[model samples]
Target: MQIRLGGLETSEVAALLAEHVEDMRRYSPPESVHTLDLDRLRTPDLTFWSLWQEDVVLGCAALRELDPTHGELKSMRTSHAHRRRRVAAALLDHVVAEARRRGYARLSLETGSPAEFAPARTMYAAYGFTPCDAFGPYVADDFSMFMTLDLADQPAR
Candidate 1:
């Protein structure tokens, strides 16, 4: 699989993001949905990436710069056809490596608190992301679970 930056223009990537948004809505209330739309993911503060196997999009993820030393993970999703193939893990590894390269002292993310999100929460925990107070523009909410990794303590890959 190849991980490419800025593939959001492709229909596959757009559909994948749309699916992500739809899934988020199914698990959370409208006001608690934090998923970014396609346009927002294209902003300057965010770096988007798509994982591909030749011509097919396998997954996608984005890193948003909250500040020079802090970043947030967004839009992480694996295609339905590609689920359980380690697609999300590969994209996550790529994002974490890129964050460390960017000198980010911390990497954070917000995911649903519903049971449907348990697998995701487990993955984040395996990556050393622990529960944390809301950061960036987010506030504490029952529908959202915040997690963070202190990159400063992580050794370079």
Candidate 2:
């Protein structure tokens, strides 16, 4: 699969993002939901990416610079057609590498706590992200699971 910076033009990338929003609606309550829609993803502080193969959008992810040393993962979604094929994994790896390259000392994320999110939690665990208390503008919510990964010692590969 190929991953590249995405342009906002209602393309496959937009479709994947729309799916992410739908997933949020399905799995998370309104108050507990934390997702960036297309407009938010286009903000100056965030860098969005799209993963594609041929002409199909396989998945997408985004990095939001919360501060100089910390980065937040956002809009990570694997298309239903590409589920379980490591599309999300590749996008995540790309974001982590990009964060390290940008000199971020830590990478953090917030995902749902429902059963629909168990797989996502496991995937984060596999990448060395451990559960943590709320950070940034986020507040403590039982439906939310915050995780962090320290990037201090790991060299970019």
Candidate 3:
């Protein structure tokens, strides 16, 4: 799959992000849903990427710079039809590499704590992201699960 830097203007990418927001809302309260909308994803500090094979978008993810040494993962989603095919993994690998390249010492994320998000939690764990307390603007919430990875020793791809 070829990972493009930005494709939010395309209908396919927009729909995928909308579906991601909808899915997040189904499992978490409105206030707990941290999924960024298209406009938010376009902000200056955040870089959005979509993984595509030929013309079809398989998944998408974003990396938001919180500061010089920190970053946050956002809007990670694999299209329903492409689930379980490592679409998220590919996007994740790209995001992590980008973060490391940008000199970020830490990368963190906040996902749902519901069982529906277990697969995501497991995947993050497999990538060496351990449970952590809230970071950035997030506060402690039962509906949220926080995980962080230290990138100091992470080998570059």
Q: Candidate 1 clashing pairs?
A: none
Taking all chains together, each candidate's TM-score versus the true structure is: 0.97, 0.95, 0.97
Please tell me which predicted candidate would have the highest lDDT against the true structure: 3
Off by over 4 Å in 3: none
In model 2, what is the error at residue 127, expressed in angstroms?
0.7
Q: For residues 52-155, what per-residue lDDT tens digits would candidate 1 score against the true structure?
A: 99999999999999999999999999988999999999999999999999999999999999999999999999898999999999989999999999998876
Candidate 2: tens digits of C-alpha lDDT, residues 46-79: 9988888888888888999999999999888898
When summed lDDT is taken over every stretch of 10 residues in candidate 3, the lowest stretch is 148-157
RMSD to true structure for each model, in Å: 0.9, 1.2, 1.0
Model 3 over residues 1-157: C-alpha lDDT tens digits? Answer: 8999999999999999989988999999999999989999999999999999999999999999999999999999999999999899899999999999899999999999999999999999999899999999999899999999999966664
CA-lDDT, candidates in order: 0.94, 0.89, 0.94
